[model samples]
Target: MNEQKIFDNIKHALGEAPRNQFTTEMHLQMIKYADNLKSITAKEFCEGVGLKPSFGTEFSKMRNLTQRLKAAGLNTNQL
Candidate 1:
């Protein structure tokens, strides 16, 4: 996907309002879960967060964000 679209999706998933609202704690939780896991597909990850898996590519995309978010101090849950 394009960078703009990817970013937009991430923003939506994180529930950032038009006013730029965000919850650092909730993001941290998502990040933590992404870090220490194996064989955990992106579809599964999105499902855990109440998102639908639209395409097979979502897993890779989400995985990348998960790592970045984790590095940014987002806490992840153990699976």
Candidate 2:
């Protein structure tokens, strides 16, 4: 492919990146049992799961996903 085409493809791929970057097994657990962790701080969450506090950023994203689910009345609590 041409240089410009390569750049365009890269950009497009970036824009189409997966919506969720929290792909670790712990992250999946966090989503599945979202209610259990929703009320805790990210640091507390990381500590509970033996992860670095720096992972708090990704934990926050998981929280956002659950929050949206709750707001839309899809939470297990709501259902």
Q: Which residue segments of model 1 deviate by more than 4 Å?
A: 1-33, 40-54
Report lDDT (CA) for all predictions.
0.50, 0.58
Decoy 1 TM-score against native: 0.34
RMSD of each: 10.2, 14.1
Q: Given candidate 2, what's the lDDT at residue 42?
A: 78
Q: Candidate 2's residue-wise lDDT over 58-78, tens digit each? A: 778876787787687665443
List runs of model 2 lying over 4 Å from the truth.
1-22, 69-79
Which candidate leads in TM-score?
2
Error of 1 at 71 (Å): 0.7
**In candidate 2, which residue pairs clash?**
none
Model 2 sits at a Cα RMSD from the real structure of: 14.1
The TM-score of predicted model 2 comes to: 0.52
